[model samples]
Structures are given as structure tokens and as C-alpha cells.
Target chain A: MGVRVQEGDFDLAVELADFGRGAGGIVTFTGVARNNDAGNLQYMEIEHYPAMTQSAIEAIANEARSRWDLCDLLIIHRHGRLAPGARIMMVATASAHRADAFAAAEFLMDYLKSRAPFWKKEVTSDSAEWVAAKEADEKALDRW
Target chain B: MIDVVYFAWVRERIGLPRESVETDATTVAELIDELSKREERYALAFSDRGAIRAAVDQTLVDLDAPLKGAREVAFFPPMTGG
Candidate 1:
């Protein structure tokens, strides 16, 4: 029902407080910034296509809603620098059936991983580099 | 003239966020070709077509995608969002 691309962090508790009413099942997935090994990781910078990011996510959320009888759905992605352990983004789906909720959640995640316009640049003590997109993530869509 | 924007490493390589281009290019491919001939940065950023993704206006489109009447174009690396 909502899609947000922002610089600020989101509180799951606050986000879910008024979420998914009257649903038999709800599934939530949160992506956190994890330190790359060699652990000198300082912070990660996220860049996004400002004009396309929100619409792209909303389109995916709509697709998820269509594929499942979702009561509600939400996608929130954070931009800007984030420290290790900071919550980066989250997706939540609600449906009358557990299977529907679960399936849609996975669908959204799979598509979001590769299709959205955000990019991650990892910063360590010595250097920073744009995270190379993974082929596996693109292949994950074939299963759908 | 079309507003051409760059993002991610493409922006870093090109050293600017966007530019205005007046062109007769009819497709994204033609536009890239035009830009590639502009300077080393443009050429380097666009040397490999496989590494670049583009959008017309704000919608993602293929390089062969038409640019007729489009006011904006954007280029960047393949999306790594999640």
C-alpha cells in the first residue's frame, strides 16, 4: 500500500503498528547493512536514481499485490550513508493465507534485488567500491 | 535538447550528474554514439555498451529504444538494489 525511498532510517515497530489489519498472515523482511570481512568497513553509501526509484518499487509492489490476494504491502528503502548494522530497507506483505503472504514476500524480494535502481558502494578502511551486481540475483527471477 | 543524466560510477567517470545535448540521434544507441565521441570521459564511460543501462524520460529502456520527443535520458550501471 506504500512505497518509500528515503535517507532516514525506519522503525519497524512504528511502521507495523498500523499495518496489516485483519490479515491472517503477514511476512516482513528487513535488509541490514553488514560489515564486509576484513571488517575495517566504515560506512556504506547508497545511491539511487531519484526519478525512477519510487515508481520502480511501486510497480513491483503492485505486481506482488496482483499475484497474491494481498491485504496490504509496503516497501521502504533507505538511501545515504549507513553504518554497519543499520537497517537498509524492508518489505512486508499481508494476505489471508500464509502461503500467499510468503510467496509474495519472496517474489518482491527477488525482483527488488536485481530490478530496482539503487546501488550500494561499500567503504572500508582502505577503499570504497561500487558493489558489483550479482548474476545470481538476476537468475533468481527465472524461478518466478 | 535533451537532459542526459548519469548515475553511480557512470557519474563518477563522467564527473557530472547531467548535461544538455542537442542532437539528431533517433535512439538511445545513437545518443550514446554521439556522446561517446564527445570526449574521453564519455568514451570511457560508454566504451562497453554491456556495462551501461539507460532510461528515456525516467523509464528504463533498451539502447535501441527510440528517443523521439523524449526530453530526458539517463545512463548508469546495472541496478544493484534490494
Candidate 2:
């Protein structure tokens, strides 16, 4: 159960090959890069705080474990340039019950969305812009 | 000297990703003020305080957060990570 910040894509099957030996349920979430509304996306450039990223993710992962009863967890996020349809990140949670696994996965998602030290910028054929954080994303944390 | 880093649009507007600054400021707000006075670029990047977020020594904090003993400070817009 850990966090990894990388520049390369991850293989889910290989990552879970030896995962969750005795857990009753395991849940996983994968985020994919999508094209702009005009369907002219070139690629996305992800910028991250190199010095703080891993530790920041680990802190949130630890918070998830503290809040939920889980057997294991895995969070992997990628940086750098990524093409559309490429995987951006993945989260997996294992627990003795399905509820814990599902809840933990959601919690990790909510926390990482606004709290993590990473940013995404969308580039199209003629222009590029940073993806603004939605107000709802910040408000989502209030539910916890 | 404290290492100040910028990300995303802040990096773009400031025209640099990172720099080291010798400062006597005691808080993040003061640091921003110092940087803003240096050039119009810095002023433009920091024009909207509400849209910016700061981290001192890798931990997120409010603008009033003390800069004492901090070796690094990062400024960026709200994170949009998944």
C-alpha cells in the first residue's frame, strides 16, 4: 500500500498481480486523458511540484487509511506529456468488505483532486490553457 | 536564500519555473508582495490572490503562513489533479 508519482504509464494487471491476497473486495479507479470539446486536443502537459508530489500523495493516502478500515491501497499518478485516451492515474483499495474498499477509493479520489500538488494543461492545435480547478472539487471535500 | 517555484500559468506569466530569492519577509503574503514589486510580470502573476495557493517547505499553507526556517516555497493556482 503506497503511492507512486511517475512520468510513464502504468499497467494495472501487472500492478495487481500479487495484490490483495486475503481481502474480500478490491476496488480500482483509472483516470484517462480526454480531448477538448472541439476535438482538437494535441496533448496534455502535466506539471508537478517535484519536491512535494510523492510526500503529498502519501499524506493523503495515509489519511484515507486512517479514516477507513482497509487492508491495502495503491495510488499511481503520472506526469509529463500524455496523449488523449492515455491513462493519467489509478487508485486501488482493498478491504475485508466491499463498503470500505469503495469508500476508500472515493475518498482518495476526492482528496487527491484538490489537495495534490499537480496541475494539468490542455493543448489544442492553436492554443493551450491550464485546466482550472472546479469550485465543486473544493466543495466536495466538505462532505468528508 | 529561499527557493521559490511556480507552476502552470503562474510559471508562464512569471516567465520562469523557479528562482532563489534572498528575502527578509516573515510570511508568504509578504513574499508575494516582494516578488510583485520586482517586475510587472510578477505583479501580473500575483494579481489575483484568491486564485493562488502557496506551499511552504512542501506543505500547503495560508498566505499568512510563516516563512521562518523555510527552504522552499511554491505558488500555483488551485490544483486540478485527479
Candidate 3:
């Protein structure tokens, strides 16, 4: 289990088939592209620094492994155009106990939300806007 | 020559993705100040320093981060990834 950044969609079942072979508990989280409140969304365009994406994710994974007793961890994030309901990314963590898995998963999510270089721009029928980073997201990092 | 890059709306406003600049600025802030004086586009894109984030050689850093030995620097909006 490692990190992957690509434009192709991933299969969750296929991804987990051989994941965390010896772990007692595995926790997984998937983020989906959501429709806007107005419900007139077309797609989301995700942009990332190609040279930094992989290493940045690897650093986050290493931090998670350092802070938890993990067996395996996987992070798969997609870039390019994604429509509503399409999966944007996934994080999976395996540990001897469920608590560690859950905590590490959350930690990874919190860090990725702000530290990663990816940006999302939502496109509607007639307008496009970059999604602003929430104040809550930066604050979420303080708890860990 | 310092390789400077931009992403998302920063790139859109700057009208390009990356460039190399020869400069003697000692900090990221000074570098931004240098670029900001180059054109109205640079000034507009960097108008709000609080809304912009800087990275030195692919590692995120403060605006005051030194540029003495930096080869690459990137400026972009706050990340909204998950």
C-alpha cells in the first residue's frame, strides 16, 4: 500500500483485495465530487503541482505511519475533470486496532486538506469558481 | 536563475504556469515584491499576500523564507484538497 496520483479512476474493491494482509482492522475513507447547492454543477477541475504531489503525499503517509502502529496505508487521489458523484480520492489505513486506523485516517485527511498542493475549481453551467480553503480545515490540523 | 511556478488562478492571472527569473532577493517576500513591480498582472495576482501561499523548491514555507539557494519557488492559493 502506497500513494497514487493519477487521472484514471480506481476500483475500491480491487484496491483493497490485497491490502492490509495481516491487519486486524482496516479503515477506509473515500471523498466524492459533490454537486453544488444550486444543483446546476457540471464538473470539477482539480489542479496539482505534478512534481510535488507524489512526494507530498508520501511525506503525509510517513507522518501517519510514524504516529500510529500501522500495517499498511493507501492514498489515491485523482486529478483532472470529475463530475458530481465521481470519487475524488480515498484513504485507507490498516492497524492492529481499529482506533489507530481511524485516527490515522483522520489525521491523513486533515493534513491532506491543507498541506497538499492540489486545488479544486468547480464549474457550473455558466460560472466557475475555485473552492476556498475553509477555516475549519486549517483548524482541524491543530487537534492532531 | 530562479524557477518560479504558478498554479490554478495564480497561473490564470499571471497568464502562464512557470518562469525563470534572475534575482538577488533574499526572501520570498522580497521576491514577490520584485515580481509585483514587473507588471500590473503580477501586482494584481500578488495583491493579497495573505491569500497567497509560497513554496521554496517544492517545500511549503512562509513568505519570509530565504531564496539564497532556492532553485524553484511556487505561488498558489491555499490548498483545498482531500
Best-fitting candidate, scored by DockQ: 2
lDDT of 2 by residue, B1-82 (tens): 9999999999999999999999999999999999999999999999999999999999999999999999999999999899
Docking class of 3: high
Best by lDDT: 3
- For each candidate, the DockQ is 0.84, 0.93, 0.91
lDDT of 1 by residue, A1-144 (tens): 899999999999999998899999999999999999888789999999888898889889988888899999999999999999999999999989999999999999998888888889999888999998888987999999
lDDT (0-100) at residue A18 of candidate 2?
Answer: 78
Q: Model 1: runs farther than 4 Å from truth?
A: none
* Predicted candidate 3 versus true structure: per-residue lDDT over B1-82, tens digit per residue: 9999999899999999999999989999999999999999999999999999988988999999999889999999999999
TM-score of chain A of 3: 0.99
Ordering by TM-score: 3, 2, 1
Candidate 2 global lDDT: 0.95
After superposition, the stretches of candidate 2 with alpha carbons farther than 4 Å from their true spots are none
TM-score of chain A of 1: 0.98
Query: Which residue pairs in candidate 1 collide?
Result: none
